[model samples]
Target: MAFVHSYQDDDDAPAAAATSLRRMELLLDPSLPQHLAGLALSQRGVLTTGQLLAAGLNRTRIHDIGRRDGWRTPLQGTRMVAVQTGPDASQDLMRAWNQAAALVLPHAALGFDSAAVEWGLVGVPRCDGVTVIVPPGKELRARPGLRVLVRPLTTHDVVSPWGLRTTSMVRTLADLLPTLDRPSGLAVLDGALRRRVRRSDLATARERARGSNGWRQVDDLWELANPDAETPLESRVRSRMIDGHLAPNALQQRLRDSSGRVYARPDMTIDRHRRRRPERGPLYIEADGRGPHGSPGAAYRDRDKASDLLADGADIERFTWDDTFDPMRIPWRLRRAL
Candidate 1:
């Protein structure tokens, strides 16, 4: 009764094929304890108790499945039958939880960080629970790992791109920006811009949110949003730089050798004129995310780039995901280098 890990977009084909085989087996087998083939296939092995009952499983049978080794009741009445073991398991489980939330409260739409996750916005921190927003006066009790908020949402604010009722990208950003910390907020904005959420659209969203709580902060985040930021870590590094009055003069700035051939494109750059001590040299800041910069080959290339920049009379600084957390860490180093 070992459950198979659910398939995610980035999961290897073998894992997806395995999950598909399991799903096909569940669908084709009539002797299965719960005749929930259709529901299981559609919901990714997540089913509500109500769905279980409607699918002809009695309370006793449901209880038996709940006690089984591979099955779990993640929410009050939602049953999740999957092995939460692999790297993508948590994300798969999260999707299931979101599905369960939608199933349980068909009237409410996913909002806030949950909607951001649904929209695939980058820099969205992982949340164990789902956040659903209901209109004012709606009475919904909060369950374990489920948050219910009362807010006024118009038809324009909601969308179901994937058949899961959730906020639109603009609405999600508008609702989520103010709630996040400064660095996280800027990161989300930069990510949204990278995803092609136009600056004008964000401006309109900001204007609509005028006079609301945290509007100023949202506006500031909108101003800081740059499509040139290629990653959440880069956006976060820029945020810290701005916080410490060390904002870079350019992002993804290109460096050229004497022959005018592009050598390296640093994540952030400050020209010598912008430097506190112009004689020190131009500064290049690298926001090194793990995936691209962690490999040995990447490390070698990075060293080569650093050497070339150093030889060119440029001061180089590299920051990682961890370095951005300390507000003073990046700024202090850059200041000393400057």
Candidate 2:
């Protein structure tokens, strides 16, 4: 039998026209994978496989796509995330959330570091698996990429700020505290406070966390988190310096020229005593967090500030997240400088 190319008669259109029309239908259908072309992949990019399945493909199709080099598998099972191909890009963020959700099973909410990405508090690492908190009764064994947490959370503790049904901000922060380093933990907390996740919500989480490890630390974390800290690292670093007695008071601080107003705000500062003289000049310490100032531009500006301080005859000491982790390094450095 002759192949039927089109519904219309041959007089109506050419064979090429019918083929073109068929191709057009495939492009617009909601079922097909919506691969965004030319989109860049960074540490901040991610996608979920469930989204692919929902895009009119089954497990077999997904496996085929993987086999054909159409996808990259970063993690196994629950940790699996699908990165889209080409520049425009196609990622199923919702599907990623759901996959993380499946691993947590009942009584879980997308939260902490994971929520920080969801709420845009910070960049989500493309390689890391999603973070979720499951209530005490529903904890999963530690999988390769999955960080399954068994904790306490009430119904009210699982609300999201952006109208999504993830864990509430307070609960998120409380859950994250012990799991993350001080800087990363504080980043999520700082963001939550800025969004004004009500005190009552945090209080409720605290009540639920009464007997948990690291639960007591949340109050201290809350008290030290300042509004000025836009990023979690900022607040946590500041908090650690304070706890370590390394933080400098603004009034006693001097970073710029004694005559000029624009000065560097170093992460921490200390006064050095003189051996022969009555007193030595104060030391200005800068905490070069993840990016110095977080990017190249920020680093350049900070360098200028440092130059200004140096011009003013101030001694400067620089440290990073690692220095903070080591208690003796900071003090020893200052002592040697002094």
Candidate 3:
């Protein structure tokens, strides 16, 4: 933990530039073990082979350490130390992924969906390893557990945070489009909007997105992204509804019982003409994706709120991730309910 410090863009640090291989060899020879250990700690238990060599360690010593129990070679030239809770955990895996990216691609900036998570603009519902967008002249070979995209980014497209270069929020959302399905893409766009990212920013990113694969799909979500969608799952569910040719009456619709008691906001409302009557035409269609529903508190709240509304003569229905993905279920059930 001694070396657990934030990473920085190399251009910002003069002393770090001094840690070049030959310089490191000379500087760390006297304290090889401590220096290497510190580097490993700083990188969330990951250390690069270049670092070991710079630390004046021979290939034989590097091999021995990598072979020790709990160590793993996740990528060429990179070694990950033992995880306290093991590598199966999402938080641990994400930390290691980011740390490894910093070690293996020091000049690369984190981009796309990964950067969105880092900015707290979105949730980590899925992991596709660490994504790094490299500048020109830096060649990164394709490797497992790591994704590298090469492009010349404008200053506006990237930002250095916690010492690591990452895509700016707008650029991250645009870059993230290719990695996501239409539903998730919409959700992320909604998130960006909810976070107050200007629509013009997305337009600029969209201009940059041209000629890129999947640009069309991502761009298509621009019109559908409503800030009213509260969660990624909700956005995805709404996308499915649209695909099935069923549009909700309203987004994030509010409701009150006959007694004027308000309830939780549902993802959308159906049959708008009955807005004045809770027991009639318009009802709520909750997008309780399985991931969120699994949380006891979330589950309790969803059910409790809906049940209370139902008792007061309100109508409600729900769909899960499975239901949305199932080609027949969601559309049919929704049609029947409506």
Maximum-lDDT candidate: 1
* TM-score of every model versus the real structure: 0.86, 0.62, 0.74
Q: lDDT (0-100) at residue 214 of candidate 3?
A: 84
Q: Which is better, 2 or 3, measured by lDDT?
A: 3
Model 3, C-alpha of 172: deviation from truth (Å): 2.6
RMSD of each: 4.6, 12.2, 7.5
Compose the digit string of candidate 1's lDDT tens values, residues 158-193. Answer: 887666888877778777877777888888888887
| lDDT tens readout by residue for model 3, 83-116 | 5343224544565666677666777888775676
lDDT of 2 at 215: 62
Ranking by lDDT: 1, 3, 2
Ranking by TM-score: 1, 3, 2
Query: Ten-residue segment with the worst summed lDDT in candidate 1?
Result: 20-29
Q: Report the candidate with higher TM-score, 1 versus 3.
A: 1
User: Each model's C-alpha lDDT?
Assistant: 0.76, 0.50, 0.67
Please give, for residues 239-303, the per-residue lDDT of candidate 2 as tens digits: 56565555544322434445876465665455544312234455676666664468989878988
Q: After superposition, how far is residue 272 of candidate 2 from its true place, in Å?
A: 7.9
Hey, what RMSD does candidate 3 come out at? 7.5
